[model samples]
Target: MTKRNEPLAELVTEAGLSEGGLARRVNELGQDEGLQLTYDYTAVYRWVRKGQRPEPPVPSLIAQALSERLGRQVRPSDFGMTDTASLATRALTYNSDVPGTVDTILELGRTELKSRGMQRRRMMTAPFVLAAAAGPSRDWLLSTLDETFDQDAPRKIGMRQIDGIRGMFKIMQEMDVMRGGGHARVTLVEYLSGYVLPLVRRQHDQEAVQLALYEAAAEQAYLVGWMAYDDGQHGLAQRYLIQSLRLASASKNKVLGAHVLAGMSDQANLLGYPEEALALARVGQRGITISDSPACMADLQILEARALAALARDGRPKGSVTEAVRRAEATFQHVRPDNEPEWARFIDPAYLYGEAAHCFRDIADTAQIDRFASESAAEAARQHRARRGALSQAALVSGDLQRNEIERAATRGQTVISLAETVESSRCIETVRDLTKRFKPHGRMPEVQAFQARAGQLLKVA
Candidate 1:
């Protein structure tokens, strides 16, 4: 049996309270905070003996209540545990004050970027998820929109701060593509709660502030959806992406909206919902066509082509890939970001080539796939070595065409799988899975079997 005089029990005794008494106090505290706790003396005893921890907001409330009743500060450590800090903890603490939340979130973003994948252990901790689920989205929305900007005293954030946040976003995006959303989801959630939430509270010129808020909200929503996708929570991801689209729409930033829509379309395509993917890509195209931004138009056209390729792969709809390619070629003629977000800085000729290659590969057009795949691979290699994520994507396209050789494709596939384990994106895994599934129907070719085996190994990790 466990010792009765454990830290929590000792603390309870020190306060002149029995296990039942402590549980009652905790319950009362929960009541004050609008939470329902079914905990009892037995629960308290288990926590004391078995190291079970209470959910957050509860832990803080217990501390507050014990301090009030005993006339002494009751630290959670006194009960053999640290304070329950979660993504929602900071957000909830500052929900009544937007500026505080924004400050906390910015600091959090910087911390996340600096640490890279080191902080992933805390991503899906129980308290963090509980708190994130409890976030006051409605309150945040109201507060964000209520503030009008003062043109005379507009607040200016430093470029360094923005860059730090962007860098974090980039890393997370890459991780999500490589590994799927499961590994570092909590980190992304905490990022939104600590960095993006606070920015939403800032006061600025109406137009500028609104634009900033919309972008931030869109990013937050995208991260949330990406996390959900990683966890295989497809329904949740869809909902969050839809919410992100709404936020983008509110800002009237069609470019960002198109990006989010493309993401949604990508998710749909991966889920085998090719028709839905095509429809969403069409929406993005329509939005881009009407906008004055040529670069944004090109990006959307590429996205549309990807969706069209997926539809063609599903054996539905005529001229999908052809139409997509035609539009993409036209957009390529006028691609430049006059005033684009930092997140989209890398969507260049290489990106178009890569996306086009994937589309042709999906349609099983070996010649076109080879042509675009080689060009994309070379372009991606030329840009940055740190883009293991993009390289993995290009490798997937190449793998699709190299289906005849299990040995040749297996080496490259293994490299991608290794890289995929470190990143947080589901797209890479989905691509590999799709490739494997496509080849499975062709019977037991030695090379295909070997590639499938390698893919299976990677899927287990994902």
Candidate 2:
């Protein structure tokens, strides 16, 4: 016999919803994700009275519905439908406590290892929780990072060892650029879980030595997060980025911390939460100063522009978008690669213009897209063509589409396919899929059909 589900029953009541209302709400939310749910009052009764669980997505859909009603970050575990081990559940907290932060990060890496490869994405329809990111972004903004190294335990780690680790990660970063995060993110996780964890555990009498170790670890973790983002495992990336931010904070490395926050902002924008994205980018801007690398500052500024452009497209004024883009371009001119931190050196012209093109696309400003996107694609690393080049080339297709140049857009789309095929990123696949969606209206045309046929073969979307 099943026990009563008091938690679920109480939550429904606290949300001020009747069983029928909750069922209808879940079905509505499911429809947003293309799920045809038949949940009714009896289905809610089975959950509340008989401890019966709904199928995979329905439970998450219920959580999302109640979260909106309650105006808080609700989880399946909150109502006893699942446990805290769930990715969204585990990522919900900022872990302000001392060893709890460390432990939480370790557990997250372990969980990633056990998640049966990239299949973790299949666990949820909407994986990245915007609310989960909000808590940590605010927590880091308010945090003093006063936590000191434990002097009573462990051994000292030298700067040379940290340098060596960075040297190796440089190669991994290159691979991620060329081959996509899917190709190397797991191996990166293996290194973080095995070798880096021990380094993080070691203590030293020299504060400088310890800080270097923390900074190095934070950067490595940030790379893992970046790879995960590139691979399209956004929820997993969000978790890793929070941990990386904490480590950077612990090291008192404000520059790296700002970079991590900027990464968070980019992820948020890409995930369609431009408001949260803008807020995160502002906090990142506030967290650093002019003394920091100009490249890092420029990156944040462009991210802000991207968010503003997204908002503009959603009915906000274009004035803010224009100003933000100007600031980004002006700041990018100040980027001195030799003076920049190794991590920030990637902020080259190609990268800056690539992002600029994206912002212009969001606001439906095709005038600048041709110049910026073409520059981005042309300036792509000559030694190895990668996902960034593919993404930059994609903006051309969008710009062409916005102008009703179906033949030109389809022709350009084949170039995107050629560039995207060199990498294993799901983000690349998703990019073409988005273009294909736009191509649907013009599908009867021979040119449009050609692009659709090619994109369909590459995307293989369900």
Candidate 3:
């Protein structure tokens, strides 16, 4: 059991806030950030009297609340909850050495396994900040290659364990494609903590074996991050992606590192950091070696175009969006499926077209969006990819809205809602929200109202 938080109690006393008062302030802060926190005095009592730590984002929120009440800066360390706060921030560091990177990544997996409270709490529900992403991204961009991964106490392991991890990665990827990331995240974390860590710590002699393991671990970590992003756990997703990037660097896998950066760019764009998103995408594109991996390069270029398109949507600038799209298209033409990495297998023309639809949507090119969305939908249907199909349908809904075809748009909106109901994906939910929010101006219409009501009920259950 943890010790009592006497320092917190003292601070509470000095701030002259009753337990109830502190709880009220914290709840208010959560609500302002769209979090549904219902803490009362009892929660505060536990923190002060029992030393029970609150879940992440909460510790930071509590510190912020106390800072306001005390008319001074109050940090998590001030309350002896530094580790809890740092758990979220630690991944932002690109360790100067390989062992440090490995330790950090392993610890993250262990923490996720041990902290049931943290797993239950939606710590990443808070708003996204570009500032939080800037440092780690810069560190990754400027990082030198790892020289060695010397362990203090090394044990030799073999290809058997590495193969096991690779097999699991394949299974998890298939499951993610079929059932969505929400369904896969819990299982992925379990595998990370239960299998991968133990194997990594075991003995391994061959440098090739070690490199293979590191790359596999990096891919798995990227999957963890990707699933988190799909579940709308943006902060958690960023942390995992950072660790993945660190692992990719340690393995000297520039292609995989580019992939990791692409994921970061995607997350940043979704979280409203369009500028940082674009920068991340460009970083990924620039980091690639021409002879290293053409598939990786094409993927990064597409992601860069995606970021520029998102920025254009947000009214930043439209000129770059078109050029970015053109460049992505041009690069995509060179992807050789037979030579692509396992991770890049999904970056087909259909995927590119679907993303291009988003770019067209951003630029208000309704006709182009319609064409691309149709192509994406047909391909998604052929492949039985529900998530991508829903995304394509989302673009179509927006296009219908742009054409002032309200009834047709509402119909497509309902289809998206129905498709979303079959998947446990936060990305799907966000798509519904975006479409529903656009429907607000026409809410009085029966179709729009019906779609919104159903979508709301679906989200509530999710």
Candidate 4:
């Protein structure tokens, strides 16, 4: 048996909290963040008696409760709790010190130098907490630094390594499109950890070379986060994106930083946080002007529109989805493909249509879904982007399902499944999962069951 008289029990007692009261306070705190915790007096007594630590975010919540009562910062360490991370520190915090940021990323990521004490279990499955990322978002907006990357870490590196990162990243981007982020993510992580970290840690004789290295490393980190998101690992993705934001800041690349924020905004939208999504997209937009990079501007605008649409659905009076959509479309029109950056090259008609289809999907506006989804699929096929083709087909299926066109929806659903099979993409599979759920109302029908069964067989998501 473990020893008794835990620091948690002492802290609770010192705070004058009763067994029932601490349980009640923790449960109430959980509610504010959408967690349906069922803590009670018995659970509290067990914790106090055995010095047992609660699971995951509960430790953070318990500390928060005590902090509120004690009118000071009460960290998990204060009570000997080993929470992986809290709302204010570690992965969630945006480190402004350039050298510290690099070291933090080296430790947090899947590098040889990364600490073995890292517990990825919680990060792999943790829920998206708005409070955890809020500070980073605010910090990113207020950030502007004239940074120096002249490190004296003994090792010497040059532009050849930077070129290799950029070259391989291009191939990786294509692989992500062709075979999903999961297809080659482990190899990519190995490359980032094994090949990239050494370049980052070394001394760069020239300022330009150092900046390029940081920027390339930032892009790789962002891609890692994207891969994690595609695999549905939300917490892991959030932390990587936060680190990527810091890297971009150190590189002095505002546009790249904006792109990083765009990824954060995109993930927030996926995880059901419209307010945070909109906030991130808005911050991303502040860095670049429309005339300078219309495609980049359009990407942020559509992301904002998505957040606005989600808010509209949630009955919040933040902004008009329709107006945001108009702005996105207008800005997209100004996109000169040849002049666009390498990253913004995907902002063509088909890409815009697919994103717009999502906006329409969020609002449940089936009126616009058919046109946008059809155009999106057609454009994706024309451009040879199979992943978007699959997602677009799924959107079409969503519309057909909504219209009660079961035959059409089932056929389209089959198309999505077949296309999804072509790529090892969890996002495409997830889209089909939603299609299956939409079939629930028509469960009495054979076609719906067939589609559901087929999805279960293919995606293992029944």
Find the candidate with the highest TM-score and give its number: 3
Deviation (Å) of 378 in candidate 1: 2.4
> What overall lDDT, based on C-alpha atoms, would model 4 receive against the true structure?
0.77
Give the true-structure RMSD of model 2: 10.3
User: 1-462 in candidate 3: lDDT tens per residue?
Assistant: 778899999999999999999999999998998899999999999999999987667887888899998998676656766344555555667667655555556556655555455443434442345676667666666663323333332222356777778778888887777678888787788888677755665567877677777788889989998988887777777878888887787666677888898888888887777788888888877666544666677667767777887767667778777777777777777777776667777777667788889888888899989998999888988988788889999999999998989999999988788778777688988898889889999988998888889988987887
**Decreasing TM-score order of the candidates:** 3, 2, 4, 1
RMSD, each candidate, Å? 8.8, 10.3, 9.3, 9.6
lDDT of 1 by residue, 1-462 (tens): 444537666666667777787788888888876878877889877777776666555656656656776797665534544332433244323234333334434433443344233232232232212222212333333433454433343222344555566567778766654455776766876777666666666665666555656566666767766677656666545545555655655555556666776766666666666666666666666555533456666666777777777766567663767677777778667655544455565566566777777777667776777677667667655754223344535445465545665455555555555555555556656666766665666436676677678779878876
Clashing pairs in 4: none
lDDT of 1 at 224: 69
lDDT, candidate 2, residue 379? 81
The per-model lDDT (C-alpha) reads 0.59, 0.79, 0.77, 0.77
Q: Model 2: per-residue lDDT, tens digit, 1-462?
A: 988899888888999999999999988887887988888999999999998876566767888888998998676656765422344565556666534555556656665665442334343232677777777777777763333334333222446777787886787888887798888887887887788767778767887777777787888889998998888888778878888888888777777888999999999999899999999899888877655668988899999999999999879998888789789888877777777777876688888899999999988889899889988888885645568788888999999999999899999899888878888898888888888888889989998898888888887742
Model 4, position 55, has a per-residue lDDT of 68
TM-score of each: 0.59, 0.76, 0.77, 0.75
What's the TM for model 1?
0.59
- Please provide, for model 4 over 418-440, each residue's C-alpha lDDT reduced to its tens digit, 9 standing for 90 to 100: 88877877788788888878878
Q: Model 1 — which ten-residue stretch has the worst lDDT?
A: 126-135
> lDDT score of model 1?
0.59
